[model samples]
Target: MMFSATFTSLCLAAVAVALPAEKRAAPTVTDILNYALTLEHLENAFYAEGINNFTQQSFIDAGLPGFAAGRFSEIAQHEATHVQFLTGALGEDATQACDYNFPVTDAKSFAQVSYLLENVGTSAYSGAAQYLSGGTLTAAAAILAVEARHSAWVNSAVLKANPWNGAFDTPLDLNQIYTLATSIITSCPSSNPALPVKAFPALTFGTDMTAGQATTVSFNGSDASSANGMYVGFISGMNTTIVPVQNGQVTIPDGLMGVVYAVATSSDSMTSDNVTLAGPAFLSFDFKSDALLL
Candidate 1:
């Protein structure tokens, strides 16, 4: 965990693996602030778009109880507050909002989109917790808590019976979070920001599961030649396995049939069984995913 220090030199040495070797100086608090700012900007835009494009009648048409404009608007305001706070904190180093293209085309999909954003937002804050200094850490923890609440509220409203999905929540690394973020993000002002973003894997699955066919699952990416094996877990993380990359693709001879909950690289091993004394981890925002493969 980062110690309380001046914003000028917030260190990221804790997660050096997440950073590139080209940088000489350690990652500063500005980096974390800028990244959080970018995410807030994106989320703000997402809600704003839905708010302006959809109406109360639209919500009713979608089979939802009431117009979610007020709820979503409040959430958007929270995100805006985060953006403003981060921008003010960064002073000259703040990142400008980038052009983004979210996937939701209709009001009915707002809750679905919120599920992805809020959960990812919560994970992003948790994963980055180690890099935050004491004061910034407290602020980040506050935001993380609200983001989780937003996620829970959305899930309860949308999914109904099972609002919270899993007993073991997954904490993703920087690359994973930013990769998902940039999937919908368009042009940016620079090649790299405080939080680095890489070109998407251009990942595509060969197995046609849309037809309910449970054939072998194989995936290919633009940079698959250099990539390691792919790891997959079900939404509950009850079942997970590894598929090796060969000849520019990762293939599972017998792919399981289910909705995938999480996917990561070989470096991050997620499936494990841990029934431990949960003491210090209560104070830690970053928690390991130790779901058993059942």
Candidate 2:
């Protein structure tokens, strides 16, 4: 009779669990870094190819500024240096190298060449600045500035206007990079033409919390600006089923008492999440803060 009641309760609980809207998992920091590195490699290769294929004489004879050759060389070398620094930092064994994807093969047509290289380069650097750290941050800033210059030069040559559409200029920072990276991963994962970013990576954690502490796992989310849509839940197949403490949130069940637990969340479209849930029935984890991407 007791077993029958318990089985019925479990069935009801399963039905309840299936009722809410699910969240797509969030990507881990490691995932962000990997994508950033891959993009840097692609940009490096593109610049290298551009340098080899474009000569100063071609632009000068085409009635463009004589300095265009030097600018191209400078940007190419800068991109190469960035690739070297990132690869060294990530280590050869850890980093995955990728091939170049240039949109155009010919540079003889100045407007087309300018549009292809400068704007694309600017977008890549600006988009990636946030995911970088330490020396990588400095490198990204330097590259971004140069890319901006390249964009300005090209825009003036092509559209007869300032490259920045606005009269104002905005500084790109790590947070902006995070924003752009999340945006790119969400919207145009395949549009890079050079680097293909997979779904944003997810993170898992081994957490430590005081008894009764509350925590929240968060990410940029699929929408990027808000944290509303993620499907967050705790592992409940074991003896103690965690209860929902709030919307799309769960907590260490009161019955868990002094035990530690393993918790996980799987996004339908993104990376999976897993973490250690340690507690005094007071333990908690903030998924966004605690997780590191694999």
Which candidate leads in TM-score?
A: 1
**Model 1 misplacement above 4 A:** 1-26, 191-194, 197-261, 264-294
lDDT over C-alpha atoms for residue 219 of model 2: 34
**Span of 10 residues, lowest total lDDT, candidate 1:** 275-284
**How many steric clashes between backbone atoms does each model show?**
0, 13
Expressed as tens digits, the lDDT of each residue in 191-291 for candidate 2 is 23222232222212213222244434323222212323343333221233433334423343332221122222234232122321111110111111122
For lDDT, the strongest prediction is 1
Cα displacement (angstroms), candidate 2, residue 58, comes to: 1.3
lDDT of each: 0.53, 0.39
Instruction: State the lDDT of candidate 1 residue by residue for 50-156, as single tens digits.
Output: 88887777777787656476788888889888888888888887788877767665665676677667877887797778888789999999999899888877755
RMSD per candidate (Å) reads 11.5, 20.2
Q: For candidate 1, give the lDDT.
A: 0.53
lDDT of 2: 0.39
Residue 39 of model 2, lDDT score: 48
